[model samples]
Target: MPEPNKDEWEQIAKDYDEKWNYLHCIGALDSKHVQIRCPAGAGSLYYNYKGIYAIVLLALVAANYKFTLVDVGAYGKNSDGGTFERSEMGKRFESNKYAVPKDKELLPAMEIPYVIIADEAFPLKAYLMHPYSKAAITSDEEKVYNCRHSRARRTVENAFRILAGRWRIFLKPIETKPEIADLIVLASTCLHNMLRNTSTNISLFEGQIRMESEHIHGVANLEPIRRNFVREVAITRDKLKKYFVSDYGSASCPWQWHSIRKSRVAPRRVQYYLLNTRIRYNRPF
Candidate 1:
């Protein structure tokens, strides 16, 4: 492969690699489905991830260490992991997206790469991997593979924490012109990167207040996002080594945060209902 040029390759290297220095044998990946009020005369073509009509924001994060952002792909309704893979970053990074260059020195190589954490809903691709199912493999091995993938992939969950944690914009349903949705997403990401780069020295509590005020939502009080982040982290760490082996069927992926909604009929049922749901938690790319 040719040597990296300072302008182009250096930016790519920074965006793809050094930013994720904390990650190990894991990559954080997930998707966030945001509600966008549909346009007039449009059917439910944008309806997705959930029964409701909305656009889904697909994101990737670095897991295996400190939580960090990798990349994000935005799409309309009816999009799944397969659908989001149509994004430029997804096509470029996914092992199955294109021919894998034999030259290991390519960007995919220079870093310490690993698995991606995903829920049962996502289909498994080679580099963007998942766990074995009871029907697909022995239960014992399935749990083993799952636990390994979970550990490294939780970073994306944490990245979502940083997002909803700071930008309350994601806390509610967002509505805009279909074409403008991607731009809003890009703006959120730009702010995220900007804040992430600005060094901070405030105390924990002070910092918490600052973020809450800035993002406009007290996400720390949002029990579901908080709980899922913790729950997924635990699931990812148990018996992890087994999933890391090459001979085994396990794989890795670019990671992101997943946003899921919970439905309830009553006030009491609302809190409990939202908390018990398995279907939605922020999943990343």
Candidate 2:
């Protein structure tokens, strides 16, 4: 995938803010496991916690559900964090190679770095935001923050859903060598983006999108591993957490309070219910 220039990055961040209500978010990051038949002599290298032989499809998706970048063929045994850290995109991010727009104000005087929203599996950094640990969440503000964060991050999840739904090959274990499977995945993602760009009537596939969204598929609820983060990074998260509940911040969503309360009672059920609600209303959460 080609890297987005500074102007394109700014546009992505703007789209994310308008649609997902997450300020300065340029993309959503996630990984999906593509199952494959165990290759010759590749014993446990591709074995994952799910008891399947697979490869990791690490992706960074834009607000429109188009893949901005992807890294395929990582060992499935590795966690998303490790896979991303080793990816070419990750290395570029580490070296600040991408022409990302500089930090800007979310509110009048409070500036925050442009960030990518990920789940708990990824580390929190100055330029990346992950949810607060479930055990560490002591305030409603944190809950609100996580709710919005999940909403924004769902773009990547939905992108993967569309990819798998459209390409039936991903529904079953790819019967091929690891090298061929990698090429298949890469080509599919490229085509997926192209189709998304060219397709005129998205409503033609609404049923498939809804069906895929309703199912609780391969998501693994692993406990978030602790890692040492810089004080500035921690403070960055806290600022955004507070902003989600602040009256002055445009990121606050009125429905989040009700959603968070329902989540406290039944997390999974509320998630499923809210997802349907969004699909039905055809609007953001």
Q: Which candidate's TM-score is highest?
A: 2
Q: What C-alpha RMSD separates each model from the true structure?
A: 12.7, 6.7
Cα lDDT over the full model 1: 0.45
C-alpha lDDT (0 to 100) for residue 253 of candidate 2: 59
Q: Residue 58, candidate 1: how far off, in angstroms?
A: 1.3
Query: Which residue segments of model 1 deviate by more than 4 Å?
Result: 1-26, 64-76, 94-117, 134-142, 201-285
Predicted structure 2: clash tally: 0
Taking the tens digit of each residue's C-alpha lDDT, what string does model 1 give over 101-163? 221222222322233446545545434455444344444444444443444344455566566
Clashes of each: 34, 0
